[model samples]
Target: MRFLVIFLLIAKIYADDHELHSKHHIYKELSHLDLTKEQQHRVKKILKIYRKELKEYKELEEDIEDKRKDIFLQKSFDLEKINSLNQQLDREAHGIENRFLQKMHFVLTPQQRKKFVHYFDDWEVE
Candidate 1:
């Protein structure tokens, strides 16, 4: 049916968007690390968990955006409702990211943690 087709298309688009987000963060983090084989294996395992969390976060964000778009497209749009939903999505995403960072910090040594922090600082300024 036409409705089914449209639903499938939208699902695929959202899935691709999530994949892109996960890949971008993974590549960025990996680029910053100088990992030995063992370290690389550990990092990969950590990243696997992070990526799953990120994918869920991304899906939540996409759902929020879709809802906002639907509201705006209606004749009687509620900006306040959309804003509240967006804020909730933002908070949830931030919480997930913070948890991931905490896990990553726990896994790294003091020196590695400093290196990770320095990498992010440098990355931000560049």
Candidate 2:
């Protein structure tokens, strides 16, 4: 069950990363919404912070990747360590993503939120 949860979380992260190739991809999506200047500024700020958080997390990701490689390469398999790393990555990734989403949800108007939510069919930010 725990492994399944970890698998799902990893899959979700991969899907999200695939969809969001760049911050500009999000900006392009928002362009269709007709956001006001202030809303645009707030969204941009939110994205900037999100990017910074992701950048900081990258080092941790690399460390985890190295650990994963070691686990696979070593004679002894470390299921426990792999699970721990998965949980940590899941928690941090979700934390960063949720913070960005919460900020975006708060910044947009109800109508804008509706449009944005619908535009990305998977996002249930409401």
Question: RMSD of model 2, in Å?
Answer: 8.8
- Evaluate model 1: give its TM-score: 0.61
Give all candidates' CA lDDT scores. 0.60, 0.66
Q: Which residue runs does candidate 2 get wrong by more than 4 Å?
A: 1-27, 119-126
Error of 2 at 60 (Å): 2.1
- TM-scores of all predicted structures: 0.61, 0.69
lDDT of 2 by residue, 21-80 (tens): 433444555676777767766776676666567656666778998999999899999899
Q: lDDT per residue, candidate 1, 42-109, as tens digits?
A: 55566556556655766787788899999999999898998899788878766765776777677677
